[model samples]
Target: AQSVTQLDSQVPVFEEAPVELRCNYSSSVSVYLFWYVQYPNQGLQLLLKYLSGSTLVKGINGFEAEFNKSQTSFHLRKPSVHISDTAEYFCAVSDQYGGATNKLIFGTGTLLAVQP
Candidate 1:
């Protein structure tokens, strides 16, 4: 079985400052990872994904993540943040075996509280 753990449940930072949301996963087989962000009253938006190839993946709003296989981590980072960046971030994983039914196992979620 595959599972994801988000070390921090909440991250508070000032506007225009850098921030990182940690994520780690455990799986027995090959897996795909993803990051998603959700604003208040909005659906989950795809931030970035790691299907294969490059270990470093970039996403929208200047957010990027490095996939570390040895450490089994994919931490999300941004050089600076905005008040609008305040939202709920999620890390998810899915193995390749389920085919059409490859459902994502998501972390508990981390709330980014961007302060002025």
Candidate 2:
């Protein structure tokens, strides 16, 4: 099975601030990358992914990530984040050959605190 690690368990910042959520993965075979965000009591939503194509990928809400195969990392970054961006973030990976039911393996979790 594959795995992911989120270096920081919590990230705090002021309103309209900048933040970066570090993510690293381990897999012997090819894999797909994904970032999901969870607001207060909401379910996780897909923020972005690095599939088979480009190394750089963009997602909703002013966030982006670059797939670095050599480093086995796909870190998320945002130049400026809003208070609304405060939420729990998770980094995940899925086997490229796994079927639709193949669940994703996620990092423990990261709580983003944005001060107003």
Give the count of colliding residue pairs in each prediction.
0, 0
Which ranges in model 2 have alpha carbons more than 4 Å from their true place? none
In candidate 2 the C-alpha lDDT for residue 1 amounts to: 75
Number of the top candidate by TM-score? 1
Cα error, residue 23 of model 1, in Å, equals 0.3
Tens-digit per-residue lDDT, 49-91, candidate 2: 9888999999999999999999999999998989889999999
Query: What's model 1's overall lDDT?
Result: 0.97
State the local distance difference test value for candidate 2. Answer: 0.92
Alpha carbon lDDT at 23, candidate 2: 96
lDDT of 1 at 62: 98
RMSD after CA superposition, every candidate: 0.7, 1.0
TM-score of each: 0.97, 0.95
Best candidate, lDDT:
1
